[model samples]
Target: MELSQNKRVADMNYFELIAWLGIGSSHPGGFPATKQNLAVLQILPDEYVLDAGCGSGLTACYLAKTIGCKVMGIDINSQMIEKARTRAEKEGVSHLVEFNIANVYDLPFPDNKFDIVIGESITVFLDKVKVYREFFRVLKPEGRIADLEMALLKELPVNLRHQMEDCFGAGTNPLSFEEWHNCLAEAGFQDVEIKNPQALKDNGNIVMNELKKDWVLIKDLTNKIKRQPTLLPRLQKNAGFMKRNRSYFGFGLIYGRKPTPVKLGFKDWVRQVIFRKKTNSSK
Candidate 1:
């Protein structure tokens, strides 16, 4: 995707900047954290997975390659979807992984279509319950959701909150771990829990560390920074804020499962039938 030369990187929002740079892992804790969460998911080969907000298709392709699961990845950004498709093709996972441009709130799939739904660093920037409910809608009975997101480890002061919005974007709200768990539960999920929770670590070179593993992306990012010199400073500003206020933030896997439908035995079914008949007759 060709970024507009007229648009300054300074003016681009956080998502746009990352998309333009083609950064594979922009979430808190980066790709290592993703690997940790994947260990906990224990995905099966036959399961169908949905990678919600899958930027550049890193995690989606990884799932297809590592676990042999069929994955459908969705992103709101066209550039992200395009890059993701390219990554899938390059990584030889194109047969098992697919990418599409779609909104998380209104997924294009039918209800109960996916065995698992995964998200990273996306829900923090949107309505958590609304997104979780949509995820719940598309998940099959007993399906799982594993969302990796930034969480508030402590109360954020009013000034820091404002600064956070300035650095990321408006409406960037990271909830406490308890609140994250409750959101999934409110969305009709069972066994909701925040797994592998930990406070933020200020690895000063997080972006470099992740990108160094992908030399192709590193070259692309270098070209991007060359084209838009303002990009680095803008990224650094956000990084600085995170490092300075790292104490107030943390991240983890917000995991949950859709409830399985109750099965009725023969006697219970007979009682229900008789009760329904009586109630109908009375009416």
Candidate 2:
């Protein structure tokens, strides 16, 4: 899958291509897994949810329809936000879901604003620690955060690792299964559960099937190429890379609970002050 001579993979990132393609459920397990995660969330109709990287807003609409809850979706990509807004309108859940162009690192909402936060394969493309911290800050006490993210089954060779990182785009440095757990723990999440790790090597077939169901997949992709002809070659190159290095990558679904704030009793406060004094003395 050689790209045209004039275009390089560096010219366009993989996420831009996905945004242009307008693919829904653009993760490893697709929508089925998305539905499963939503089901287990046990959402109450009265609760408010955040879809952190709601690409096309499919999950947002689904959440609204399934639980009749309010869903606010935020994405950094303006183009994706526009498409997501249109999808929400089309699904007749525009009133139930709001789409905004916003960064995950600094969410526009105030602290403790949401009952639940959900993301699908989004954390892999950001500063995971910072983004998780933001997710933690915005969630109410005992609120849950759930995500489906890419994970490396094993370490790749140095050259292969560099190549994959460069080509995968949007900071797509996937963590190992254990690393993800530690990341969540460090971000102030307790009871972290990383589960259902699946091999991504043969998952291209799943992605293709989902895209095939979209009658306008080619149409949207062609429109993207017309707008920026150089993107075609870069997209082809990404495809080639994925086909070649699929074996090293996989996906994981994660869930974590934000601990409820506890009131400190006299003994607990004394212990904390002593601990703080000892920490400062050591420093």
| Candidate lDDT (C-alpha), each | 0.90, 0.79
By summed lDDT, the worst window of 10 consecutive residues in model 1 runs over 207-216
Q: What is the C-alpha RMSD of each candidate to the true structure, in Å?
A: 3.3, 4.4
lDDT of 1 at 227: 77
> What lDDT does model 2 reach?
0.79
Candidate 2: where is the Cα deviation over 4 Å?
A: 1-10, 205-210, 215-219, 225-233, 267-283
Q: How does candidate 2 fare on TM-score?
A: 0.84
Per lDDT, the best of the predicted structures is 1
Q: What's each prediction's clash count?
A: 0, 0
- My TM-score estimates for the predictions, one after another, are 0.91, 0.84
Task: Put down candidate 2 lDDT per residue, 61-129, tens digits, no spaces.
Answer: 889988899999998777778778887787788889999988899899999999989999889878898
Model 1 C-alpha lDDT per residue in residues 146-196, reported as the tens digit of each score: 999999999999999999999889989999999999999999999999999
Top candidate (TM-score):
1
